[model samples]
Target chain A: MPARVIVVTSGKGGVGKTTSTANIAAALAKFGKKVVAVDADVGLRNLDVIMGLENRVVFNFIDVIEKTCKLSQALVKDKRVPGLYLLPAAQTRTKDAVNPQQMIELCEELKPDFDFILLDCPAGIEGGFKNAAAGADEALVVTTPEIPAVRDADRIIGMLESMGKSPIRLIINRLRPNMVQDGDMLAKDDILDVLSIDLIGVVPEDEGVIRATNNGEPMTMTLDSPAAHAYLNIAERLLGNDVPLMDLESYTSRGFFSWIKKLFKRRTRQY
Target chain B: MDFLRKLFGGGNDGSGAKAKDRLRIVLIHDRTDISPELLDSLREEIVSVLSKYMEIDNDKIEIDLDRDEKAVALVANIPVLRIKRGNVDYDKV
Candidate 1:
């Protein structure tokens, strides 16, 4: 079967679109599924850096678009995973360097070779966002628990719906469970209520994610990371495993291990 | 047991409230493309319609727009004035 193309986008900046893309792609690859991480942000490309593949980007997304390299040649194989590859965006270019048609054709070439093509989208409601979304078979919208992020996500959902690419799944990232309990933060259900879509994952704010990205490593590459497990769980759930959403309290305190403890406690306490 | 549940169980209800309250308002603005001024004008038109009938009291009448699932509608209530309720108030007619 052809690969499923998914554009990971958030209408607002600093809301984890790139992070989610890198982690999810890496997680999917770790699950033994073929995966390609496409940095579609063009001039501001950073997925390669986040995935620790920046130094090795010989042929880029624009290279594939301009036909300077074969689509397979453009794919930079990840040293860490067998089937994971990256099609990095050109570093010194802007959004106008490639159009939506070029993106659609590029993904079409990649479809037969991979199990998943994950596009790391640029922020905002602009041309870059439009081009990144054009070829995706599915969309995974990332949003923070904050009001502004949710509002922008709603606008993006409205725009996608207007373009007939609707029913986008939501992933509420950077959630703080303590704040949520203290009535200071937006919860996952709250974010989902406004966006009104099926939720694929809820990522709790984790310092390890920031550290991993700074270290040029995909957070999903570290199985010990709380966020690593969440990403893997989401990827597994994507492959038709009915993993339940993580409990927020456990997430904020001890990460996934604590979350598992709470799950069992809830089961035992059910009287 | 009930109190323990109260203290811990429903902790994350704040976002739920914010979403329902704020998104409903924002979505109304998005879909209808109607400004507050338009809504005000619409309310005025509803009041005028009520006035042309029996002794309609505008002070007690309230008309507004609301979203019902996926549709927008003008929801209004025109209270019959005390005088109008007394057999259509033909006193000055």
Candidate 2:
């Protein structure tokens, strides 16, 4: 079967688009599916660094497009996962280095070899975003619980719908369950109500994500963290499985003792 | 006061609710591509055309774009004081 080209995009920056792409690709590969995470940010390359394949990248997507290297040569296989690969973006090139037509052709060439091709799109609604989304069959729109992120997600969803992309799903990142319970932060239902897209995953704010990124390892490779479990569930959902959303309360519920502890901590700080 | 509210579990409507309310109003304008100025002009033109046949309550007129699940509607609430009677010329106001 031809690969499912899925673009991971968010209209606003710093909303975990690259992190989600690396982890989801790694999770899918762990499920025994051949996956490649392509960084389409061009000069602002990040997936390679996040995936811990930066030092190993000798050629990039631009190299492959310009005929400087074969597609196979440009792909950097993940040493940790058997079936996962990374196609790093060119650090010296700009967004204009490649166009949507080249992106479509690249995805076409990757279709026969991989089971999943995930594009890590650049932020904004300009040419970079268009190039990343051009050849995709599906899209994963990432956003946080904040208003600005949700608004941008709505705009991106409108664009993706006009582009004829099917199964556009939402991934709400950095949700603080405690804040939601306190009615301080937007809940999952609130975000879904605004975006109105089918949700594939909801990842809580996990410190382990930052640690894993800095260490150049995907959390899915260990399956030790709550966020990793969420990404795995997302991969299963993408494969047409009816995996239920993770019970986030299990990870966040610290009971009355922790709340009382926080109360005293707040009181002590007033001095 | 915030600490006391947290202790009593008596939270107000919350900032999340405010955010949702703000987004709804902003998105209505965004989705319809209609600015506030455009809506004002639209209301003026509509009231002028209607005033030729009826005594309209211009100050009380309201025009808005309302959105639901599948579609958006241009809803107008224009109160008329009375209807004008007589044969009206097509071209002459």
Candidate 3:
């Protein structure tokens, strides 16, 4: 069977597009499925670093597209996971170095060998975003619970719909539960109300993500924190497992209040 | 201080509720590609056209662009006091 090409994108930068791609790909690989994390963010490639395969990148995405290297040669295998690979993006070349059609063709060549092909898209609705999205069968939009992020995400969803991409799912990242309860940050319900898309996962704000990135490790590998478990659950859901969304109260001070809110929500849905 | 503010339920300056309201307005404008001035003009035109047939409460009239996942529409709620029937004061009759 052909691999499922999934592009992880967020129009706004620093919203965890690359991180989600890396962690989810790693989690999938850990489940013994063949996965490739393609860094489509040319000139700003961090997917390789996050997967701890930076030092092994002899050839990059542009190299494969330009026909300078075979696609297999460019795929840097992860020592940490059995079936994970990293197709690093060129750090020196700009986004225009490759086009959308070329990306589609590259994924076509990779489809037969891998079980999943994850594209780590660059921020902004530009050449990089076009190139990343051109080849994917599905889109996983990563967003933070902020006004600008949600607005950009809504725009991205609209664009993806116009392009006729089906099953576009959302991953809400960096949610500060404490702030959410305090009415200082947008809650999960608020983001869903605005974006109006099927949600795949929600990762709570955790400093462990930063630490894992600095160490060139995917947080899911250690599964040490709340965010790690969230990423793993996302992987499970992507694999067609019906994993329930995590309870936000566990990360908040007003647990009983949030529980009451949940009970009220359930009761309202019964009607 | 936080507890006092919570108890009194007043110091919600720059809160998430305010942010949601702001985003709602901005997203509607962005999706419809309509400016605030354009919306104002549209409202004025609608009011003028409706006034030709009936006495309308312009101040009470509500006009907004509502959107969902599938469609967007202009929803207007104009209060009508009486219908003007070809130079006849129907309300007085």
Candidate 4:
């Protein structure tokens, strides 16, 4: 069967588009599906770094597009996940290196070999955005629960709609539930109301994500933290699994009370 | 402003709420390729045109552009204060 081409995009920068793409692709691959994540952010390529495949990138997206290397040569096989692959973006080239038509053709080529082709789109609605979106069957727009991010997400959705992108889903990244509960941040409902897209996943603000980034390991590799669990759930949802959203309240740290409660319950059970 | 709101008894109209409201209005304009100023002028024109036919409550009149997944709609809620009776009444006709 042909692969489902999904584009991960956000009009604003630093909202974790690449991180989501890397983790989701890894999670899908972990489920035994043949998955390849294509980094479409040509100039500022970081997906390869996030996937820990940067040093191994002999050939890149531009090489495949420019017909200098075969698609297989450019795909860095992820050893950690059996069926996972990463097609690094060209760090030396610009977005103009590849056109929209070429991107569409690339997806067409990869469709037969991979089960999922996830495109990590660059920020803004420029040539990069157009090229990244040109080949997508569906879109995942990632945003934080902030005004600027949400506003940009709305713009991206509108643009995608105009371009006839089907079934665009929302992924709220770095969501601080405690802040939302304290009325310091925008709630999920507020974001959903504005964007009006189907919710795919909501990742909590976890310090582990930063650690994972530093280590060049995606959170989906280990489902220990709330963020990792969220990414894994998103992957499951992507595979057509009807999983309920993670209850962030329970997932949040209750501080010393939970520890004391656990101790108290253990002592009472001894009787 | 946020500090003031924090000091005072701010209800749902916190910074987040304000952002939501602002984004809603901005998105409407962005989708329709229209500006807020243009929408205001359009409201004024619509009110003037409607006032010639009926007694309209300008203060109560609401005009906005709303969008869904497929289409965009210009929704106007014009409150008719009173209907001006024309020269030819329905009963007489």
Candidate 5:
């Protein structure tokens, strides 16, 4: 079978769409599946940076679309993962430079050799989002456990369903288990109730994610990081394995250990 | 504001709570492509039509619109003006 084009999108901004794209792609690649991560942000490209492949980009997604370079030429092979590659978005061109038909054609051409193609979509239901979703076989609606994000996601899911897309899944990102336990935040079940879609994964709020993202390293590269393990489990589930979800509460420190973490945080200034 | 109140229980809206509420109402209407002004006009027209046909207690009348299960409805509770007063005057009959 050819690659399944999964566009990771959220209608609202700052909901970890790019991070999920990078991490999910990395996870799939690490599992020995051929995956190509495409940055579809165009003018405001961030996936390249998230994947830490910005410095090596000689060509971009626009180059492939414009025929300035072949699809093979635009793909930047990952340094650590053998089967992974990234086709980065263009920085100099606006979204109007590409069309939905071209994106569909590009994905069609790239499907044969890869097992999964993850498109990191830009926020909003604009031209760029349309182009990104045009080629997708399935959609991973990334949303935070917040009202605004969930509402926007509901709108997006409705639109996708109206467009006759099927198997649209949800990934709740940046979930704070402590807040959920304390009744200060919404949980995974609450989100699913609103969207009423199949839940694919839930990622905990991990500070290591921030540390890794700042260093332009994908959190998935850190195998033991809770977020990484959760993402890897999500990838396995995506690949037809019915892996259980991660338990973030187990990772929470208590008693003496909790006191030590607080003391350490007090000693180190937060960035 | 209602949605934030419903979701976050009014958290994260302290500084711009009013603005966020306004935006939420506006966005909900905008995305649904429905206008509150249009609804108000519809209500006014319906109430006017009701008043023209019969004597109605306008103060106590309530003509409202609602969305239930993606369905639209006009719900009215109009009080009829009594033709006779004084507890139906049973003895006078």
Candidate 6:
């Protein structure tokens, strides 16, 4: 069977589009499925660096499209996970380097070999976003719980609906539970009320994500991080498994108790 | 501070509610491509055209885009004071 080409996109930048793509692809590959993470950001390629395969990107997707390199040669295999690969985008070229038709054709060529193809789309609903979305059978729209991010996500959802994409799912990233409890940040229910899409997963704000990125390793590689568990659950849900949503309130209450214990310990030591 | 306010039941309507309200209005405009100014102008044009045939209570006129799950409708509630006498021939038949 051909691979399921799914584009991980957010209309706004810095909402973890590339990170989600890398982590989900890695998680899927870890499950023993063949997966390829395609960086379709064109001029601003970061999937290679995020996947920690930057040094191995000798050829890119553009090179394959232009017939400068074979598709297999352009694909950079991730030694960390079996059956995982990276198709880097050319940093020097502009988004106009490839059109929607070319992207569709590329996905066709990749379909037979891989079990899943995840496209890391660029920000904005311009050529780059359209090109990335053109070939996908499904979409994973990522958004943080903010006014601008949610508004832009709504616009993207409208566009995806017009394009007739099936089963558009939402991933709420960087959700701070304490803020939501304080009625400051938008809650998951509030976001769903406006976006009206299927919820795939919610990744809590985790400092470990920064460290994992700096090390060129995704959060899913380790079993300790909360964010890693969230990403793995998303992979499971994508595979048609009915995984329940992560209990964010448990994290909040646990944090509160830990803080109170630390404060009591400090006061006793001060005496 | 936030916890204290929440405990006092003072800040229940925080910025989250404000954000949701603002997004609701903005998205309606975005989806229909109709701004407040555009709606006002449309109401004015409708009032003018209706006033030529009937005496309408202009102050009570309301026009808005009503959105449901499937479609948006330009709903107008125009109050008429009286119909003009010479605008129509009641005995034309």
* The best candidate in terms of DockQ: 2
DockQ, per model, reads 0.13, 0.34, 0.22, 0.22, 0.06, 0.32
Once model 1 is optimally superposed onto the true structure by TM-score, how far is the C-alpha of residue A269 displaced, in angstroms?
A: 32
**Can you rank all candidates by lDDT, best first?**
2, 6, 3, 4, 5, 1
Question: What i-RMS does each candidate reach, in Å?
Answer: 6.4, 2.3, 8.1, 9.4, 9.6, 5.3
Cα lDDT tens digits, model 6, A1-271, are: 8999999988999999999999999999999999999999999999999999999999999999999999999999999899999999999999999999999999999999999999999999999999999999999999999988998999999998898888899999999987786577899999999788999999999998999899999888775688889999999999999999999877776576766764564456335
Stretches of candidate 2 off by over 4 Å are A262-271, B1-6, B34-93
- Candidate 5 lDDT over A110-197, as tens digits, reads 9998999999999999899999999898999998977788878988888788766678999999988766653557778767754679
TM of each candidate vs. truth: 0.75, 0.83, 0.78, 0.78, 0.75, 0.81
lDDT of all predictions, in order shown? 0.81, 0.91, 0.88, 0.88, 0.82, 0.90
Q: Model 1, range A1-271, lDDT digits (tens) per residue?
A: 9999988988999999888988899899988999999999999988998999988888897987888888878889999888899999998888999999989998999999899999999999999999999988788888887767888888888788777774478888887787776465766766676667889888888898979888988888877777777787889887889998777686456577865675565456544
Error of 1 at A188 (Å): 1.7
Which runs in model 4 stand beyond 4 Å of their true positions?
A: A254-271, B1-14, B35-93
Q: Estimate, for each residue in A1-271, the C-alpha lDDT of model 3 and write its tens digit.
A: 9999999999999999988999999999988899999999999988988877778889997988888989889989888789989999999999989989999999999999999999999999988999999999899999998989999999899988888887899999999886776677888988889889999999999999999989999998889989999999999999999999988767765577865775565356334
| DockQ of candidate 1, scored on C-alphas against the true complex (2 decimals) | 0.13
The fraction of correct interface contacts reproduced by each prediction comes to 0.17, 0.44, 0.51, 0.41, 0.00, 0.51
Give lDDT: candidate 3, residue A147. 88
Model 2 chain A: ten consecutive residues of lowest lDDT: A262-271
Any idea what lDDT model 1 has? 0.81
Best by TM-score: 2
Q: How well does model 2 score by local distance difference test? A: 0.91
In the predicted model 5, the residue pairs found to clash are B1-B21
Candidate 4 Cα RMSD after full superposition onto the native fold (Å)? 8.7
Per-residue lDDT value at B87 in model 3: 68
Model 4 C-alpha lDDT versus the unseen true structure: 0.88
> Cα deviation of A252 in candidate 4 (Å)?
2.9
